[model samples]
Target chain A: MASPEIEELTQALSRLPGLGPRSARRAVLHLLKKRESALEPLLRALDAVNERLVTCSLCGNVDTVDPCGICADPRRDARALCVVEDVADLWALDKSRLFPGRFHVLGGRLSALEGVRPEDLSIDALVARVEAGGIDEVVLAMNATLEGQTTAHYLAERLERFPVRLTQLAHGVPVGGELDYLDEGTLAQALRARRPLG
Target chain B: MASPEIEELTQALSRLPGLGPRSARRAVLHLLKKRESALEPLLRALDAVNERLVTCSLCGNVDTVDPCGICADPRRDARALCVVEDVADLWALDKSRLFPGRFHVLGGRLSALEGVRPEDLSIDALVARVEAGGIDEVVLAMNATLEGQTTAHYLAERLERFPVRLTQLAHGVPVGGELDYLDEGTLAQALRARRPLG
Candidate 1:
């Protein structure tokens, strides 16, 4: 029988994205075997992250300090705000190494089908911040999913009254992304959303 | 520019199985966003596992203390032994809820191609323990890989000199393992290894 402690470790590891019971077991076994090499470093990193980490009060992103380095920086464009559904979306945009403005993370998209409503999102804060007048542009950098579109449209409607330019992400096809690799809907939408200059 | 701290965190996360730069970024972002609810718990679990965990000095399996509960327990068969390549192998055997005797982890299999020799393993200790004479049988339960087979054969030959019974794990379709579902190689192996019961 597996010890309760080992079981707990496995369960905890399984909670990570893409990790299942089998993979979790394999990972734990690997960790146990290389306890000094991998596990100790992992443990130390975990503790360090936990003890020092905080959140960006403005964008709801994780950081080691409140407001985060991005939000606190004086040189960043306070006038340009990129709105994304989740912190993943924010990181995706950041990886482009193009955007120089601040971000607003909504945590998740509006999904009436899933009962996620407008009020459940951080849209109110975004609207208030937009009305505060420093923001000149608001880019909806959400995933091109059904819910993502719904949320973007909803936010667009709300921001119509506020004085801010709106835009969306456009560029090369993702590096490892494929057409057959993409679903029918996403492929069709990507084609339809194709722009000139590329 | 991203902070060195954030970069370091991302690098550490990248080392985890299946996590690359993109996945690592997403995970770090998620951890930051759910700092209190998810990240803190993960950090605590990692810390606790590292600080409190130990390995069984005798069997080399991970545990909360040296010798492990299994090795320290008075009821387990100290006389009979089961040999395996990795601690994971031992855990898998344990999961069967069978195998009453204690275990001996060889750390890994012997592979001339990989420069692994018997002397590189715990073979010396295993031989000494077997020679001490209480052991009636030693089961060679190493993996079914080529290296594992070689290790098993070598150990069997070495231990043949001692006054102890030695045997290898039966080669056949695994229990809950199907023939048609088996790959061509495994199917061929199952056929080749067929035996008649007396």
Candidate 2:
């Protein structure tokens, strides 16, 4: 039989997203083969992340430091704060290079079926940031899913006490989207938000 | 944008066999979410592997202890040794729990296209193990692929001078395999090695 250590490593690896038992075994084998190049560095990186990463005090974003790089950067528009569903969504928006503002991460969207509540997310921290002033606009950059919409509506109502103009990602045909392939909801949104010709 | 640590961790995770950039990011986020339960333990496991794991001098298996557990076990049938193409293969066979004998891991198969020579693999070590005596039979448990076949043939010829008996895995339709779905070569082998009806 395979040694318990090998089995343990494989089981741990299988817990990763997109990896199953078979694939985990393969990955473990690959790591053993390239122990110096892949495995050791990965171990070091994991240790660094586990030891150094912390939640940003201002926006609840995962950061190596207290405020995280984005929240701490002075060059970003402090007046515009983009709210996202998760750190992954925040990273995706940042990768697009479209939004040039700070971000606030709400741990997860509201899901009552799964027994998730508003208090389960970082909504209180977000509200605290908005109440502190200086933000001229709050952009709700949550996903288009039902839970995301519910979370967005809830946030819009909650942030009404502040003097900031609240907005959300417009529902319309995405960039490079084809009309025929577009869903009915997107088509309707595009028609409703249609602008006058120049 | 993600911190340098997050980016580095993501990049390192993406190098794993089944994980890609997007999945790696998700994995990093997952680890961050379950730092105490999952991430810390994983880091500890990797550290242990990095600091403790070594190649078994006798069997070429990756082990936390020298000579590995299987090689050190005195109860195993040393007379019947199973030889495999890689540590992955060895682990797979070990998982099957069918073979009760010891093992010899051939780091990789002899591949001509990849410029992999016999000397590049652990074939020499295997020969040395066989020549040391007490091993009455050597089961060539290599893959059925071209390179695996070439390596097996080479080993078979090389071991002809030794007193130990050599045997390769039997070829036929796999268990639960349908004859119509089976390949011609497998069908041919099944016909050639047909046994009397029970």
- Best prediction by lDDT: 2
Best by DockQ: 2
lDDT of each residue in A142-184, candidate 1, tens digit only: 8877788788888999999987899876633566897667677
lDDT of 2 by residue, A119-168 (tens): 99999989998998999999998899999999999999999989999999
Candidate closest to the true structure, highest TM-score: 2
Note the clash tally of each candidate: 1, 0
In model 2, the clashing pairs are none
- Give the alpha carbon lDDT tens digit for every residue of B115-160 in model 2: 9998889988889999999999999998998899989999999899
Off by over 4 Å in 2: A177-188, A196-198, B178-184
Model no. 2, DockQ:
0.68
- Residue-wise C-alpha lDDT for candidate 1, range B1-198, written one tens digit per residue: 344555776677676666677766666666666667667766666666777778676777777878887788788888789999987788789888688888888988999788888888888888888988889889999888888888999999889999888977877787898677887777787789878987
- Which ten-residue region of model 2 chain B has the weakest summed lDDT? B44-53
In candidate 2, residue B63 scores what lDDT? 81
